[model samples]
Structure formats: structure tokens, C-alpha cells
Target: MISMSPLLRLALLALVASITGWLGGRCRADVGDFAPCLPVFYRCWPPKGLAGTPICQRFGNQYRFATMYSRQRRSPWFSGYLYTVPTGRRPEPQLAYAEADGNMVPFPPGPLDQKVLDSQAVEPDYINSTYSRGHLNPSLHHRDHEDRTSTFTLTNAVPQKIGSNDGPWEVLEQTVNRTLGEYCLGEAYVVTGVIPYQKDERWLRDHRVAVPEYLWTAYCCPDYNNSLPKELREAFPTYAAIGRNDPNSTEEIVPVNQTAKTQFRGYDVRRMTLDTLETYLKDRFTTAVSVFYERCSGS
Candidate 1:
């Protein structure tokens, strides 16, 4: 190894710091806020009255989705994106992880950084745990391989029970995919989030990540096939639903289906109007929670 003079070493260190700072700025510009991803939101307006750090999910040098992350909970408040008609089968998820670069979360096929493991959930957070790393923005909603993989980041996930993650909630995601794929003529914007318990918030891996009490999802389809099916008439424009993540929880919000399959029982999902969803949200957070502006009036 070659040793430089003390003065030269100090000058090199300053130059490296300046370059790192500039790169961080550039990374934020690309994947820090919703400004670069307004098209993902309905009417270019995201949900209001929620507090969290925004992360633009990028993969392979492209923006895939937007997630509002909570540093305290080490999870996402919600993930908003435009629906795409899927063309291929779902990608295999292995721990379904990502590497974080500043505010950007990228799903590269490589080992995760130790710094990322320090801040968010790692493979061990869910290993042997009762909860799974449930995705807020399910890969079923996107068409591109990269877009689908971009959602694997832990920041966009919540600690959801296995039954809900792979059972009824999975059905809900598939149903939405079929509905949006067929009836939605234009863009279908979706926002999926979680609801915490009133008194006791569950945590995973010794409080490293919080487990949600419920998982809620809402979609805004500004324009759709006018020949809508009668059963889906009330579902046009905007619709919302909530699913139970914990079976032992109360049945006020999402009632448990006692007669469900052995594995999927107690993880029932309830469909409701957007207003009703917001009402529950307001009740929990004690403030207004709007998923879409003016109920997705604009196309």
C-alpha cells in the first residue's frame, strides 16, 4: 500500500465527501418524492393527512412505485401506483428483499447492504416468525418484471400473518387484478396501507418492525367501461376494502369468517365504500384521511 502525505490525504477525503453528497442529492431527485412519480397517483394527488417518509421504488435504473415509509415502525404507511395488465407469471420471492440507496429502494439480485439491514427488516425478521413480509403494493398489480420486483423492499411491507398474506388477502389482490384488467378502460390507481391496533401495536424481531392489525386497500379508476356489470356498479370510480391481519382482534372493522378454510379462517376481507374506509381511518388516526382527491372525480 502507498501512503500519501497528511495534507494530500485530507484533500482526497474532502473530494470523496463532496462526490458522495452530490450522488445522494442525485439519488433523492430521482427517487425521493412524488414529484417524479405524480402519474402513479389518481389525478396526480396522493393520499393526504398521513405522515411518513416518501420513497420512490426504483429498480434497474427506473422508477417502479412510490411508498410512504415510517422510520419508527420500519414499514410503509402505503404504496401508490398505477395498475398494469400483467402479462407474465409472478416472480419467485425469496425473503423478497432489496437494497436501499438513500431514499430509493431497488430490487437488485444481490446481497443486501448491512446499513439497510440495520434500518429495516431483514431475512431473519420473518424467519420462524408468525408474520410474513406482506406487500403493500402487490406484484400482481404491475405488468413489467422490474415494476413487480421493485415492490419486494421491506419498507413497502408490513408484518402480516401468513393466513392473510397468502389466503383471503391474496384472493383480494387477484380479484382486483381481474377487475382492473377487464373493466378498467383507463388508468387504475391503487393505494394499499395498514391499520394499527388501538392500544397495543404488535412488533416483530424484538420491536425492530411493527405488525399491523389490519391491511386496507383502495382503488381509484377514473374511467372505466360504461357497460359495467351490475354487481360492480357501486365499485366504479372508487372502492375500498379492509382485511384482518390478526385473528384474535375484534370484529368491528373486519369480521372474522368463522367458517372459512382451516388455514384462511379469521382473515376475512370486507368490502366497503371509500367514505366508510376513510371513516375508519379517521377514527383510528383521529384526523381526516383521504385516499383520493374528491373521490377520484377527474379521469
Candidate 2:
């Protein structure tokens, strides 16, 4: 075999990075003109149809986590943060802000200039709305106090119904933590996002934020223990899930259980293989939605 020249090797590397968005073991941070300034270990799989504004969550002049927000929805299309099961009590929720690429001023407790940061969702937007300020990146997923606190930014939230947010959806989040914490041997890359309606979109009470019809999440764990439980044989390499955000949504994707308690009757979570999840997403989005490259395969 012939050896490649140093210049030739460099050129090939650049080509790979451009196509795959994988650089130095982390997904590229620059998604469309915005640099989310993600932590070194964080990964991003930018979705189609939405403009992403990268948020490097800062508190007390320290970088905690990162999020890719959507201005059109006035909420996060998705947020990426490292996961670690907490060791102590979950931190009290404290809403914060990001200046994007604008000012260096610290995040204050009250209102912020929406113009400065490519627009952000404010606290008042959800004040009287029936939906809860649901977190895309939940606080319970991290161990550090600041890391958990960083998840409270409104830009990282969406208008989620209490039935889904506090019920089955919350259970899914906890189950993920337990699963990853016990089975995953190394780092696990997770991406949580939303799916809008094909037509006749739903909006919040303020009409400024769009409410998602379905909430979807997937995780890629390339490294894991081989000694697996009989039931978890297919859960190792990767898995995906979709939960109903609207009770009236069609039962084709997630079948509603009429017998479920009143609070969680219509909100049901369906777990499936990554490919299965993608099929549903493509049908709804009218395009392929690739959550992870090669389904986070490892040889």
C-alpha cells in the first residue's frame, strides 16, 4: 500500500469533517452562522427546517451547558448537555438568559432585550399559559449544581402540557438516567427534540410559542457492557422514543390508553428502535430526520 502525503491526509480530514460534522470526537458547534460554543464533549445533530441559535449557558461567569434554540417557536428545538446521575437533591429552578454573540453583561433575573440574542422566550410568555415550561435538557440529568442550574433557561424550554411534562414524560427522563447510569460503559450522546404538526399547527396561549404535537428523544451509546439483561438485549447500542404531547393526536404513532388515570390518559410514550423512530419523523417532517450518524455505530 502506498503512503499518503501529509498535505493529502489533511485535505481528506477536512472533507470528512465537512460531510459528517464530526471533529475531534465532538460534533461541530457551528450550525448555520451560529456558534453554540458547546463544551468539548457535547455533540450536536442540527435538524432541518429551523434556524438554530447556539446558547452557551453561563452563570456567575462560568460556562455550564449549551443549547440550540429556535426563534420561530420561541423555544428550544433541542438542547445538548452531558448526562450524569445526580448525587444530591436537585437544584432549585432558576431561569436565566444568554446574550448570544451580543454583550458580555451578566444574566439578570428579570426581562431581557430580545433583539440582542437572536430572540429568546421570556418568563411572561408562560405565566398564564396552560402549559408548563418544560426543559429539553432536564436538571436531573446532571450531577453538578451549576450544570443542573444551567438547564433552567427559557431558551432551553418549550410549552409542554402538565399531563405530559409531569407525568409519562418525566418518567421517561428518569428511566433514561437509570438505564444509562447502569448499562452504558462510556459516554452516551443524547438528542431530545420536538415534532410539529403537518398542518394546522398549535400555539401557546400567548400565540408567540409553538407547541409541539410530539416529543422525541434518542440516545447513542457506542460503548456498553456486553453482559446484558434478557429484556435489554436490543437497548444497548441505541434506542429512541416518541411521546404524545397532544391528547387528540392520532393513535397511529402512539396508542392512547383509555384506562390510564385522568392526568396521564392521552399522553403515552412509545419506545422503539432508532430506525422505527426515524420512519415516523420522516413521515411527519416530509424529509429524512437523521438523529445520529450511522445510528452511532461502533465496530
Candidate 3:
């Protein structure tokens, strides 16, 4: 979903805005702003204070989600989308190995990239790498065939450790699904991002992709049933969480549970107030990072 000439880009944006295509076709446009895809956000408001290139994730000729991507880090800063109650089993991720400007059929690793600017390319960077292709806007959160498949794009992923991707973090996602499916009576908006290590940051074997120290997610559901259980009363209209991606990381952010099962022991996910998550995000990015508008006020 984004780069081209300024005048040409503006013309294309105008053209795409006027033309509507079928859900089975392809029409992608990488915009400088979120002007055309405001529906993906809650109350038509995207998160503010984080910096990255904007990608209107257009798949099957439709805008399904938005991704804020980092060129230098070659990973997504965050992905924002509207959530629906999911059905059926999860499908395989249809990894797009294309160069950002166009799909590189057979995707030769030799051709250099432009626009999306992973010159080293995403596929080559992760070959035999220790990390997993963690989805910032995961498939487990969407329902339609195209919506689920749209979440598979490379621009929407990051380098995540196996423990964090498949452990408590996975459980957290499922919990959110159950909670939202049961309580949320209207549209639910979610934004998931990463917290990179401030010092001595880790990299993949090729150093082409940066690995995050933590993965953060928050959801806003302003409309919901009033009969929430006492334990889950405070979970809406907003709730946030941060998961540890490094087992060796200190316990200050997310303390590791040492006595847990072998696979899930060190990778802990901490659920906290949205303000608390933003506080840590601000501290890490050295700027005020807001996840939801007015902290997802239901008023």
C-alpha cells in the first residue's frame, strides 16, 4: 500500500478516491496521510505522536486496515484496524514477497527495492532467522476472507520471538477476541505497535530488520453491553497490554514468570491502563504517543 512522484501521486490519489473496484481485484495506493482510509479508525481518529510512513492497506481493491511503517528499521511502527467477531480456523499467512512498488512475481531477491524501502527485502532478511513474522494486526482479529488475508502483508509485520508470539501473547489475543465477541455491541478499533529497546537494540542475523523488545496492543469499544462482570468492568471502553519479546530483558516493564510452563515462562504479557501503556510508549519514543482519542472516552 505506497511511493511515487508528488504530482503523479496526487493525481493517483484523486483517481483512486473516485474509482471503486470489486473486492476480488487489486488497487493499492501509499498515501502521505490517512485522509482516504479514516473508516479504519475509531471515531475516524488515528493515533497521534508516532512518526512513520502511512500505508492504506488496500487489498482486493478495498481498504481493510492501516499500517505505519518504518523505513530505517524495516518494520511496522504500528497497525490500526477495526475488529469483528472472527469465524472459522486461522488460515496460512499469504506472505507478499513483492517489492513495495509492485509485486515481484517469483520475487527474485536480487532486485533492489524502492518506496517501502527494505533494500535488503523482507523475505531474505528472515531466512533462517531466529524470529517469527509477528503480525501487528493479526488474522485472529478479523472475520472476512479478504480481511484475514489482508493482514498477511509484510508491511504489517515485525520481528518477534517465538516465546512471545506463541505464548502468553497468543493467549492475550484470544482473551481479547472472547471479550470483544461477547461484550462489544458495536465496532471495535484496535491499534498494535512495538517498543524497541532504547539501548543496545537487537537485530536479526542479517541486521536487515530490527527486533522489538516489546509488543503493545490496545482496543477501543465505546458501545457495549452494560452487564459486564465485575472483574471485567474496567476493560472498556479501552484496555491495553505490553508483551515481553526478550526473555533476558529486565522485569521493570513486564516481569517474567519464572515458575510458568517451559515454553511460556519468560515471555509475560502485562495488562494495564491505556495511559500506562502510552506512558511507556512516550518514554521509549521520547515523545507523547497516544493510542486512542481522549483515551477512548465513551461519552
Candidate 4:
């Protein structure tokens, strides 16, 4: 048999050590504000009171991205993934559920049992439902085929309205791709998450997954080209947006457009600076939702 290289052996040992440490004790379900293990290239901006399992998305035995998943809602609160200009064609959608540390076995397309991994949303959760399976870390930001494919997991999705998913939200995602692809000289870190209603919580058809009222996304790019178009200013370093998921909701945050087409109405996306986004989040969540450290600034 061929011998393992020194670097490979060290990596294997580290992975074994991490697994042992995680399995050594009882898993805590409370929101203790513990930092989850992020991929080597990622930046952490974990929100408060996010009581969920932190999943380092593994695809083909390689770490693809990071996500903070909530088993209670059976959806991800947010997913942090690095952004790179597209070099290959987009991969076909192959959705699957995450097998958390071997907690979920016999993995196949079917209903999820809460007892196994505290209830993960599966393909059936979206079937015939009014909402679409919206991805937090969209596939368009990655360059590798596996990275794009890894984004199809149900754990990284939320119950998003079709209007928002296909309308302005999609435009915003495409705009980000173009902007970063052209100006950003270095890696871009994107954190996309959802906001719950103030009082009444919405759920899917089967009531197995919770639906978000608004989808919020923020990006931190430390290095970027200084010569940006006047219209594209305030985009570098950090920027954020909040998209409306409910048509009947109030217009205080994201106002609905009455003159727009019937299908795309009320799914407006309001873009703003990072501080303004946090203000809205603080008011909505009743606590500070810091998306980046020092707003990704360097003095």
C-alpha cells in the first residue's frame, strides 16, 4: 500500500481530533453564543440567539462552505460562503439533506424525522407548497462545480415566496456577481439570512419548516478596486439588503410597489449600507444583529 503524505496525515489527525472533541460531550441546544468552526477562508459574523447546529458543508469529502442551521425551524438562519467569479457553467440542481456527523443515515430523498437530527427539511417540504426553496448562499457566487453543487442542500434553504425568489432578489444576486467579479480584487465573504415575524410565525404546508418574513444579506469585501463608478459607491468594504417575502406585510421597511407587474409586485429589495441594515435588524429582532466585526474596516 502507498504511504500517506505528511500533510495528509496531519489533516486526518486534525479531523479525527475535532470529531472526537465534538462527540465527547453532550450537544448543547441552547443559544450559548458559541462560535462555530468556519472554513479556513471564511469570516465569522454569527448572530445572537441563533440556537442551531453549525454545519461545515462537506461535499465530496471537502469543505465547501459554512451554515448555521436551526433544527427548530428546519431551515438555515444564515449561510456564509466565499464569493468568486464564475468560471464554469452552472451545475444542475441536485438537492440533498445534510447528514450531520453521521446523525442522519440512510440518506435519501424522503421525509425527515425530528428524532434523528431534530427535523431537517427535505424535498417533500417544498412539494406543492406556495413557497420556493430559496438558497441563502446562492450557487452563482462560487467558481468550482462542487462548490456550486454543494449549495443545493436543503439545510441552506428557506421557504421563500416565488415573487421574491425570481424577481428583485434574483436581480440583486446577479448584480452582486457582476460588481464583485469586476471590482473586487480579493475574496468576498457573503452572509445571507432571514428575519422572522414580530409576533405570528409562518410555516410551510406541512408546518415542518418555518417561513421567513424577510431575507437579509450582507457582504464583506476587504480588498477592492478603488476606482468605482459613482453609482456603485458604498458597495465596497460592506453592503446589505432586505427583501420582502410577504406582500401583505407593512411598508415601513421595504415598501411595496403597486404599479409593478402583478407577479413581481411587493417583492421589492431595499439595499443600504451595513450600519443601516443592522439598525433594521436590531429593531426587528429586538437585539443587535451584527453581521461583521467593525463593519470590516481597517484603520
Candidate number with greatest lDDT? 1
RMSD of each: 9.4, 5.6, 7.1, 7.1
Q: How many pairs of residues collide in model 2?
A: 0
lDDT at position 4, candidate 3? 75
lDDT tens readout by residue for model 1, 134-182: 9899888889887877777777888899999899999999999999899
- Rank by lDDT, descending? 1, 3, 4, 2
lDDT of 2 by residue, 101-176 (tens): 4322335755556573346666667888888988988888888887777777777788898999999999999999
lDDT of 4 by residue, 42-77 (tens): 334444445577777777777677778888889988
Winner on TM-score (2 vs 4): 4
Task: After superposing candidate 2 on the true structure, give the runs of residues whose Cα lies further than 4 Å from its correct spot.
Answer: 1-51, 59-63, 100-118
Report the C-alpha lDDT of model 3 over 1-299, residue by residue, as the tens digit: 56678999989877766653331122232223875576677656678888988877877666788888887788889999999989887876676644444332233456645543443236667778878899999999989977888788778889888888999999999999999999999989999999999998888765668899999999999999999999899898899999999888899899988898988777899999899999999898999987776787724
Error of 2 at 159 (Å): 0.6
TM-score of each: 0.84, 0.82, 0.84, 0.83
* Model 1 local distance difference test score: 0.82
lDDT of 2 at 61: 70
Q: Which ten residues in a row have the lowest lDDT in candidate 2?
A: 33-42
